[model samples]
Target: MSPSSEEKNMKKWKTPLWAAFAAALVVLLSGVAALIYLDELYPVGLGPRQPIPFSHRVHAGVKTISCFMCHSEAPRSSRAGIPPLETCLLCHSRIIRTYPYIARLRGDAALNRPVIWERVNWLPEFVYFDHSMHIQRGIDCGHCHGDVSRMDRVVKARKFQMGFCIQCHRYNRATHDCYTCHR
Candidate 1:
């Protein structure tokens, strides 16, 4: 083939290759965005293995314990706080006194050691959420928490990103003022 013909063939191949490259880049970027949305950039990765295997189903379902019974601060505070270890001991001190896990908890309590539980649900630092406000407005815990009473091990049921909260606000006709959440 002539040099001109060779150049024409190269350019033809280059166009298809460039198109393929662009398609691949878009696919890769899309995959990354999906992962970020699903993961929600938690300090602990999805479905974290807690130090002690706590069973929400056993406590909240079988025993009929209210969520606020353990997480007492949720009704009055901005944070749906992690229950202090003493909360567990209230019933555990007698109910399953000799169980290995209960014993371990007893030991930890004796030493006054804190349990650093892996967070199951979280929101970003910039967004301000008041658990008390939501509760007072009659939003169920399962609205964001996905029915922990039914779960043996709690997992993040959905993404807690901006769009998620915005959708709820829109559905409820709540104010979307920037300062309401942004501050």
Candidate 2:
């Protein structure tokens, strides 16, 4: 083949390769940018809504209640158990019995109706998270949950994306196995 013909063929081949490379780069960068954007918005803390507008600011900050006191089961199970009605009654049974806001709670508990607490935190169905393992490992709840020690209404603070999870594991030199969280 002549030199010019060989060069033309090489250029033609290179064009597709370069285009594929550019496309792949765009996809990779987009995935990374998407992960970053999601991480900022959808954190791994509470979702939204509460039954009685329970303020962590009051209970955790002013009253100094430990996080474990209410989310008492976080260190033991995948699901953090909700505070039983009896737990609330421990204080409201007498402390605020006469207050109109609390009177309804008293009436409901008397009737055995579970308080309809709106859940504030949740993960997507595909991800399997073990609160016990994280807690047992002495991981700071604030790492993924943000500084709820100051929040009134709980909000999602950590974007619980797969990349975010892997990044966190990498930072802590922990295992980032797919089966660890996928199954």
Candidate 3:
């Protein structure tokens, strides 16, 4: 065989080295992904990371700011819409104008950017929940959200499992006709 063709044939010969490398990479990546998923499912001493560190302990607890003030849509809408940066700026514009976090908020506000807060509690897409209905029923936010006044970093206090909702409904004497939530 010609020297160049022989060299090309040698290069084309299959080896286990590439296969081993790919297998090792897959195992390593899978382990990392498992750790991340497990951490999210069961956080030991912390909650999920947010883009900003907004504290409920300081805002709702110490400051005694009502939940309605920030979650304005709770009273009238099906979902409680997260307060926009403009709403936060109402107080932050003057309260902590020099703090690094507030300063970042100000910058975003200047550019008309909104802060995206993470939702700690979750409900399945098949289940329909109405914040206004619950609010009208005189159920305080603490019933579902736990005492936010005591929490700095929000964490899920309890799983929103079917049994949890059923129990609450039974105690409150609310309907349990499946359609009440499963709609």
TM-score of each: 0.73, 0.70, 0.74
Per-residue accuracy of model 1 over 40-156 as CA lDDT, tens digit each: 543332367788889888999888999899888889999878888899999898887988888999899999999888887777789899999999899999999887777878888
Question: Once model 3 is optimally superposed onto the true structure by TM-score, how far is the C-alpha of residue 103 displaced, in angstroms?
Answer: 0.8
Candidate 1 to native Cα RMSD, angstroms: 10.8
What is the C-alpha lDDT profile of model 3 across 1-183, one tens digit per residue? 457987888888856898989999999989888887888645564556678898889999999999999999999998988888989989988997999998999999999987787778888899998999999999999998889888888888778999998999999999989988887
Give lDDT: candidate 3, residue 108.
Answer: 95
The lDDT per prediction is: 0.86, 0.80, 0.88
Worst window of 10 by summed lDDT in candidate 3: 40-49
RMSD of 3: 10.2
**Quick one: best lDDT, which candidate?**
3
Candidate 2 lDDT score at position 54: 73
By lDDT: ranked, best first: 3, 1, 2
Name the 10 consecutive residues with the lowest summed lDDT in model 1.
39-48
The candidates, ranked best first by TM-score, are 3, 1, 2
Model 2, residue 134: what's the lDDT?
Answer: 88
* Candidate 1 residue 45 C-alpha distance from true site, Å: 12
- C-alpha RMSD values across all candidates: 10.8, 15.4, 10.2
